[model samples]
Target: MTMRAALCIWILAAVICVGRGHAIVKHQAEQDTVVDSRANTASLVNAANKEFVFRLYRKLAAHADSQGKNIFYSPFSVSTALAALSVGARGETHQQLFSGLGYNNTLLTQENVNQAFQMLLDRANETTRGFINSGTAVFVDNKFKPQPEFLETLRQSYLADGFNVDFTKTTDSENTINEYVKEKTNGKIDKLVSNLDPSTVMYLISYIYFKGQWASPFDPVLTKEDMFNVDENTKIPVQMMNMEEELHSYYDQGINTTVLQLPFNNSYSMLLLLPDDMAVLENDISRGHVTKWLKWMRPRRYDVYVPKFSIKTSYSLNDVLTGMGMTDMFGDRADLSGIAEGQKLAVSEVVHQATLDVDEAGATAAAATGVGIMLMSYRHIPVLKFNRPFMVIITERNTENILFMGKILNPKME
Candidate 1:
């Protein structure tokens, strides 16, 4: 699948349909000496970033789960994995891989996009108080020697953790992949790759981990078992935490959904999205509606009730990715020659594993995400009860870069 795959998956969310092959171009850096400070460049980069995150979520949310199952992953994580590979991608291999990851070669340069993510990561990791981390790595078969330029780009741009191993030694190699995932995600995701195909040339992955403290702590003493309406037919008990004080929030009258922003000490926030209808996940959420909803939000205080929940999800993104126009890199026509001297390279598997934990204090998450690669929002506080299926997002306040997202279809499913 190439840019035209964008045509096949266009309806996953209408946001990305505009990215046609010839019509769209890679991102172009503004002709400024300090590109980061250029307002126009920053705005375009932010829009592209948000569009990419929303695009990935719309695609995954549509196909990654079965009926009644909750799902979550870092779009950034998946994109990061693909971005690392893009460093070594060439010819159609580079186009398909980068395009699938939402890079329009005509509109933005990889360097421009990479710099945007780098800035976002730096902003997220600026202080160690509230943690958000994204890193890349390559598990190469010892037989292959990666191009120095490819390795250098990964190191400089993505802060990669590169490794070499004998793919023929399945036991040791598998352990190595899992161990790296385990260590990077602070142990939240221990095993991402189970087995490496003997013919597998290299396995690339990215990991993201986040843990944030609520600006205003929810009192555990207020926690009580309550019913969360999964739907009209199913109501399950959940440990509900309450914050009675007025809190900032946004309520979209059009969608009849309420959005609440809970801040962290480190300039990050977990945005909760609660809609009256539980079946919204099955329906395509309008992209522009969310942008408007976020813009409309103003600080208004109100009481809030949220459940204490924990859940984990894992996926093989091959089909989902191909469905979204990323077909070439996984197949023979792939030209990942930029990675090595002469041996042809193609991705064998893309795996993602994610987990989320939320309580009165805050939210913590870890995972190995696919492009299995690696990677937010607003609110108001009018008295709200998240007594049904809702959504949660962790993001940086400045760039609004999403670190993680989850759809709690059934709070008790975990």
Candidate 2:
């Protein structure tokens, strides 16, 4: 029998699809000047920086899955890791070139950290609003949130850690990509990603665009008369989309778990894993079993059955990330001196916004639009089983970039 698979690649992989493989090109003079100046300061600079950024993301994302928490992927981790790598650069070092981006160790404190976060948020909010040319209903914030003392410790340790640091900002390039991502994500996320507050050393920018359809599109008519499993002995009334047929790739058996892969247009796919043992294995399945299962696969079309559903989730990753393994970036031991002349700096927040839609046909509904319209939808057999905890992974076919990583500990809450 075919097993379920859900692999979480880094967010940048989606860049491959930004403009039909055009790479969202930038003018040479513009990028070259920024590179020439900050080259020595940032160790993980250049196109190759994406590799290191994703490698770090894979490890951290796996850890989050293992912990059984609802974790959202972002470029925040990549930017932080890059900043860490730039911790101790010299004038000749590329690290030295980015001297303008770091925090003043002297000014590193809780109040200052808050100011930096708010600054970035304000800029992103303004830039995104401008791109939409209208106000959006999207809510946004940062991922790193730690106590003031915890943040201070992260800063002290970072300075004491002695890592090479390089800091610089190229608004033109960052904003350009930010605009594309905002357009693709439908203004769910903002552009203008910057924080030159002296404490910040390096920056990594990531873009994610997801347009998926529910496996089962709620029949405005047949969506009635369905009972959803709420708990061990509880059930609730919900309009569930239901359809059954021979499915191409699907899980046949797994205690109470249900696993299904819903295909989108361009070889892109969504892997949904429902655990039979909800005792807390969703995270493990997300990190461990998914990759292993992908290795053994067969391709064929079959009849499918799924539920139609729609959900839009917004999350703040500050606590979830620190709880995993990024505490150093926000404490006295933060060590981002390489980005600038300042000593005090720590990560303050990470923000993520996501939307999912599923219906009968496939993912075609989401991507249904003319080119450059920043629109996409899906058409797939709806797989409705709200009986247990579950996870979802959205991936691009060519580069295998994971646009979004999520888990629903309590579907009832959603």
Tell me how far the alpha carbon of residue 256 in candidate 2 is from the true structure, in angstroms, after superposition.
7.1
Clashes of 2: 93
User: Which predicted model would earn the best lDDT?
Assistant: 1
TM-score of each: 0.82, 0.49
Name the lDDT value of residue 124 in candidate 2. 29
Candidate 1 residue-wise lDDT, 70-176, digit = tens: 87777667666676667777888778776776667887776776665555445445554335556666676776677888787776666666788887798888898
Identify the runs in model 2 with alpha carbons over 4 angstroms from their true place: 1-184, 189-205, 212-225, 250-257, 286-288, 295-305, 360-388, 396-401, 409-414
Error of 1 at 210 (Å): 0.7
Instruction: For candidate 2, give the lDDT.
Output: 0.38
- lDDT of every model, 2 decimals: 0.64, 0.38
Best by TM-score: 1
